[model samples]
Target: MKFTCEKSILQEGISTAQKAVTGKSTMPILNGILIKAKNNEITLIGSDIDLSIETKIKAEIIEEGNIVIDARLFGEIIRKLPNDVVSINTIENNSIEILCQKSRFTLIHMNGEDFPLLPSINENMIFSVPQRILRNMIKSTIFATAQDETRPILTGVLFEINNNNLNLVALDGYRLAVRSENLSTDNVISAVIPGKTLSEVSKILEEDDENVNITFTPNHILFNLGYTKIISRLLEGEFIRYNSIIPEEYNLKVIAKRGDLLHCIERASLMAKDGNTNLIKLSMEEENMIITSNSQLGMVREELNIILQGQSLQIAFNSKYLIDVLKIMEEEEIVMEFSSSVSPCVIRNKEINNCTYLVLPVRLLNS
Candidate 1:
């Protein structure tokens, strides 16, 4: 394959595709990025079997061919190359040569035929969504996904679309985050997308005003954004019935400034660092709310006047989980609903309208 392309554009394409390349794969070809040149375009692909990323960029094609080059080396070389135009050519001996100005480098190339085939996604059942909304949803919930591999389904984010609403749910047993938005589609479908794949997709998505088209099947999910398309394998399992976890009513409700509550919880978490249980105590007394954390190292106690109603109650929770949700909150104030000391604490952003956080309390050891 021979192509001459602008270094900046080429670098972006290589960097995006390389996100799927596995460094320690048993198959050596999986570590390489496939390059295909044809029709004045260069297509770059990288895969680790479960996830694949492909991008097509405009290039002046001198010869239409394909080859595989080491992803790591290719990325490094392209990143360090001068901003001038770059010329790439693959010879019959399976050697790829890169030239820019007076700098030249030769890399060993592998036959493209040996690379694994990526799944072909049909255009049917495809729906478009604002990239910003998708990115925000992922950012708000992906962090709560479980990192454990024991229950593979927990390691992914549950995407449910129904009745013209797009719902993104993620949980790590200890806490759960759910966000919903009104999308322009009525198609109903659900898919469990691995957290790792969503993270890689987030990186390739640029800051733009364009929308991305997403397609899903029984076994695979595809995302098409501009010239890039990402295909990821879907996890096979039933996600927890998250609706059952949400309390239908609350015994106590407290409204507080998001910033103030976030700071208080963060400071309280410092004392909880002494133990794996980052527990913080919450008590409602009259017109104020008390937040405290005690551990072997130290203790933190603070009070914030809040707009509260209903019966007074006390609860304990993992402060880290609350702080994580706080970091993603955009509203100035939030309503926190509590059912009981042992029940989950629900957080709702007033301005956001459709986002909620449910954090299961950490039982007091001495209770």
Candidate 2:
């Protein structure tokens, strides 16, 4: 293929597609990027069996053809090009020549025919969501997905669409995160999207008002955003019944400033990190909440003013778990509900119930 394009545009397309290239793949062609040039457009594709990414950019096509080039080498060359405009031409003997400014280089190319075909998704089961909103939803719950592969379904986030409401749920046994939003659809659908795939999609998505089109079948899910598309395999298994686990009532509730609680937990976590359990204790007494952590190395204690309701109680939890949810929250104040020290502690947004986080408290030996 022969094409001339602006360096920045070409670099972006290459970088986006290269996310799917696997460095340790047994097949040599999977490590390369397929480039197809036709009708003033260049399409770049990269795949690692389970995940694939494709992006297109406007280019000046001199000779319409297709070829596969080493993704790592081609991306580096385009990124380091000295000139704004770059020209790429296919040479004899399965090779490509790249030219920009006064620099030129020739690299071996693979036959594009050997590349696997990307799955064709029909427009039958499709939904549209704002890119910014979808990104936020993924960010809010993707962290709670389990890293262990023993229960493969937990490694993915559960996406459930019922009528106009869309809910995203994720849990790693210790904590569960749920984010819900309203959509303009009445269709019902559910799928388990791997966390790794969602993480990559989040990075590529822009914070804009543009809508992203999503389509899914029984085994795969497709995301289309402008000239970019991502296809990922769906995890096969039944997700845990998350609704049955959420408690309906609470015996204690504490309302505190998110910033103040975050700071206190962070300070207490310093000493807790040295211990094997990494536990931080929370005690609600009268109008103040005491946060403390005791470790073999040291101890930390802090008090914060809070509005307490119901009964007073004490609970212990993993400091990292609380920090994970607090760091991503945007609200000024948050509500924490507890049924008992042994039961799960629920944190929620005060303005709306769009986001909810459930963290299981650790059992204190003395209590």
Assess every candidate by TM-score. 0.97, 0.98
Model 2 agreement with the true structure over 238-291: per-residue lDDT tens digits: 999898888979999899999999999999999998745779999997899999
- Residue range 129-212, candidate 1, lDDT tens digits: 888888888898998999999889999999999889888999999899999988878788989999999999888766665889
What would the TM-score be for candidate 2 when compared with the true structure?
0.98
Q: Candidate 2: misplaced stretches above 4 Å?
A: none
